[model samples]
Target: MHPQIFGVLLLALAPAQVFCIFNRRTWGARTASSPLARFDGPASLVVIHTTNTNPCSIPSMCKSVVRDLQIKNIASNSSDIAYNFLIGCCSGVYEGTGWDYKAPISHNYKDPAIHVALIGKFDESAVPTHMSQSLRALISESQLRNKLKNSFTITEHKSNSSTRKLMVKNFLQGFAEYKEQVNDLLLPEQRAATSTTAKPAVSVPSSKPSSPTTFSTASDRKATFATSTSKPTTAKNQFFYT
Candidate 1:
């Protein structure tokens, strides 16, 4: 090999870096009466969400938040927590439905998006530095674990038309930066040319057999749905947690 070309190749092939797995536990989770359905198929979208609950920076409070969410989801007759992972302000990541497993989350389009949520609301307060960093890290790990292509779209919950009420207001503006950061981790071909958050949502039919999935709102008591015959349709931009 030519000396100069070999040196260039060495520089291009940097050391592969892997992040530490966040601590995961299910003690606070309410077991779903039935095993979670298999949704571990190939994914290319990641949806970000906030509990929209009181912000809890403390670890104990965060655990309770997770517990309550699981309880709420189960009571609503969901198979389990609808999201694949949840992050506390300081507590790292808590396992939810987990990867490749179907989460009964997305509203309109549901081809290939994975759902991830934060423990507290971020519409008003900035997402703490720790939480934001960890969220990105977790997403990166998720893609690697699922063997997904390096780049996947990251979107906020409110981006969906029917679920605008579920939006985390303050956090919406910063989604572009988040998208850039996520793209930075991708290989050249996989990097997104632009953030897809502002793009209008294209609603199709509910991918699952049930009615359109609803985001958990503050006052929604009966959020669960029985079986429905809604047809499935694909959105223009297949996104996270569609």
Candidate 2:
């Protein structure tokens, strides 16, 4: 083929090329005991979360933490890791359930949404610049791959329980920085809304605790969902137990 033709072909294929994300296989994720549920359509929302645990900056450590998370979820009777993706402090993105499956927390959202968790406790520490950049890149890649809608809205994960306070402070700070950084990618209406505290336009049910268990350690906290109450927004939406 002519050089110009070859150059054009490369340009055309660039959008589909892999980004910095580490897929489940590459991260050594355990196979789900049962097949995960598929999304009905492209995700329209992006939910951000924190691991409430130590951060990992290297690929080996990040992969171990990711695998540990998967194990914990399975032991809790979860189908797999709850988030669709997880970002390490410096290890780039690690795929959780990936783009096709519905996250275990999906029931909390009115529309399909992908969950991304930052692999570290953020209550006191600022989100690392590298982690933030990796997250933004992952979101961009998601749009390019059609895993996320171009107008997808981003929201932070909130815990209804008071015991879960460790994530609130810095998580909010990190979220603000992230929202601003991705302003160009958000829906126009969302971008126009200047208030970081503004409520989500769409309403979803709030997860109700069933046989709730509380842990003194932030890392060990867990809660099971049983029922939900109709809520009028996703912003500051409380879904996690702690």
The candidate that achieves the highest lDDT relative to the unseen native structure: 2
Model 1: per-residue lDDT, tens digit, 29-137?
5556576566655576676777766766555566677778878887888767778777776534556766646676743334466777877654445666545545544
RMSD of 2: 17.2
lDDT of 2 by residue, 42-91 (tens): 67678787787788977678889999998998899888888888888753
lDDT of 1 at 54: 73
The local distance difference test score of each candidate is: 0.47, 0.55
Clashes of each: 7, 0
Model 1: residues >4 Å from true position, as ranges?
1-26, 159-242
What is the lDDT, from 0 to 100, of the residue 34 in candidate 2?
73
